[model samples]
Target: MSGREFDLVLYGATGFTGLRTCQYLARNYKQGVRWAIAGRSASKLEEVREKLVNIDPGLSTLSIIQADASSPESLEAMAARTKVVISTVGPFLKHGEPLVAACVKQGTHYVDSTGETPFVLDIIRKYHKEARDKNIILVPECGFDSVPSELGTKMVVDFLRKEYNLPTKSVKLSVTKLRGAVSGGTLASICEVMEGKEGGMKDTLDQNQLVPEDVASKVVPARITLPSVFYDHDFKAWQAFFIMSFANEKIVKRSHGLAVEADGVGYGPEFTYRESMSAPGFFTAALASLGMGLGGAALSVGPLRRFIQNRILPAPGTGPSDESITQGHFTVKIIGESSLPENVPADASADALKPIKAIATIQGGEPGYSETCRYLVEGALCLVQNEDRVRNENKITGGVLTPAYAFGHILIDRLRAQNVNLTVSKL
Candidate 1:
């Protein structure tokens, strides 16, 4: 890794998020941090480099590597040249596996902004053992799909343990404030998942399907069921089905599972995580819930999905207006409830033993694009700058990992420094 040609390589640099990530790197580029921009088109990569050079003239000399997701040899070459790779290419189900395989073959650490859970489960099942054996990590969903959800949950779990010395029993996350637009890449990925092209939506429904068998074995199956639309007393807001919850909840569960495997204890034996989008009133919540359900139903059908993809949604590589990207924002509120400690008196009244509670919030700008670029770039830097520390501190040998398990507090600190606020307190 020390002798690698570059410290990091931004693959798919021409894509919407990839271009944003390149700009982010240019604006925040540190001295002596060797990095390169790569994609299938040398011309597109050069164009991106030119834009970056405008931000910093020094980037005029920035290297460009021509690599395509379809070309395994090119991907391997790119992977071999860089110690770490950040991929923004999607819908990953169609074009992601080759690059991941190449990265693992080249022993390069990898990160991506993929939200497709079936693809993630596929990678974990196929490459986790080999990646672990090679001592290289591959972390997907480093972007808005689940980074905030996973990391926010970790913050609450840590608070419960440090403040009250109690294990977390349940954690609920609500997207209380979200003002953002969809990206073409994101929409494409959603279409693919809805079409059942990559292992189907069923793969994402069960928590056990997303994690390794050993880790899943220790998890206590959840018993409580939540409605699609409900009023949450904790947040005093009506809640609806959050589009990203299917992916986020599974990622959070995997993080907890990995923690349990690492230490024999995690959030807790009965820990369960659920997520929803908050609305101002019950009517809004109901409308949102119905809209999402209808949208999903439409996407699941062949003709309607094609119509939506071709006529309604933006094409791949395109996204929201710059103003939308600049003005968009989101806030997720996380609540963690503590379980009874083993030392509780046998005769203690149930009413007297109230579960301790903690709240954590993750705030950022433009969930689908701007803030996601920051999460993707910072996540890659965390791996680059704290490789040995993260591995040693977490007792992780490397594999397909969630953001919290892979970067933990290092990533949290990085995001905070970037003004992507993550805060926690006792309630």
Candidate 2:
């Protein structure tokens, strides 16, 4: 990888998130970080480069590579030139696999901001073994889809294990505050899922679907089913099903499964996880749940779906205004509880016998785009800067990995430095 032409390449650099990623790199460009922008249109790539130069004249020399998702040759060439690739292109089900294939073939690390669960499962099934054998990682859902949820869960689990010698029994995440607008790319992905394209929506319903078959077979399924709206005692807020919960939960579970497979222990043998968003009151929570349900149901209908995409949603490559992005923000709280330690006596008091708890929170700006770019860029940097630790110390032979599994505390440290706040404490 040291012989690669560039340290990183931002694929789909002309799209809304892609361009922001370029800007993020420009604003934070380190002296030795050699990077380039890549996409289908040379002109658009050039435009992005020019914008980057405007931010830091030092980026005037930033390179550009023209590659289209539709062309395998171009993708292969792009993969060959870079040690790592940050793909902002989606809906991943429609146009993501070829680039992933190219990266594995070239032994290049890869990351993407895809919330589509089926596509993730597809890639893991198809490429995990080969990528692992080659020692190159491929990570998806590095953005708002699952980073906060997945990594936040890790913070809680790690804290309990390190500080109290406890194995977690259950974890729940609540999006306590979210103020963000959707992007055309995100809407496109949602539309694909609702339409049952590729693997269909049913594939996402299985909680352990993303886990490897061998590990999943031995796993005990959690029996708790959250209602559409409920009151959460931990966060002390009315809760509703989070729009991204379906995707995030699976990613976190996959991380747990992979950890167990690698070391025979993960969060815990009976660890269960769930996610939801917070509302001010019970009525608001109910309305939010109803709205999400109705919106998903409507999108499943062909006529309604087309109308929404064509007439209502922003077109691909377009997104919220800069002001909107700056003003948007989100906060996720993760709570992990461990069962009583084996050493506890049967005569212990009721209070002493209670589960030990740890809480962690992830806070950042504009989840969909602004902070997401931070997550994506920082994730890539973590790979470039800590490749040895990831491969050797962590003993992680490359695979289709979740963010927590692939980068772990190195990524958490990077995000903290970038002001994507992550804090954990025992409760």
| Backbone collision tally, model 1 | 0
Compose the digit string of candidate 2's lDDT tens values, residues 250-303.
899899999889877788888889998999999999999989878877898888
> For model 1, what is the error of residue 223's alpha carbon versus the real structure, in angstroms, after optimal superposition?
6.2
TM-scores of the candidates are 0.96, 0.97
Question: lDDT scores for all predictions?
Answer: 0.88, 0.87
| Per-residue lDDT of candidate 1, residues 1-427 (tens digit) | 8899999999989999999998989888747679999999999888998888889999989999998877899999999999999999998999999999999999999999999987998899899999999999999999998898998899999999998888999999999999999888889999988887433544556765665688777897733333489898998999999989888888998898888888878888889999998999989999999898888878988888999999999999998999989999999999999997777787988853888889999988989888889999889998788888788877778899989999998899888888778999987
Clashing pairs in 2: none
Q: For model 1, name the residue pairs that clash.
A: none
lDDT of 1: 0.88
lDDT of 2 at 222: 35
lDDT of 2 at 364: 88
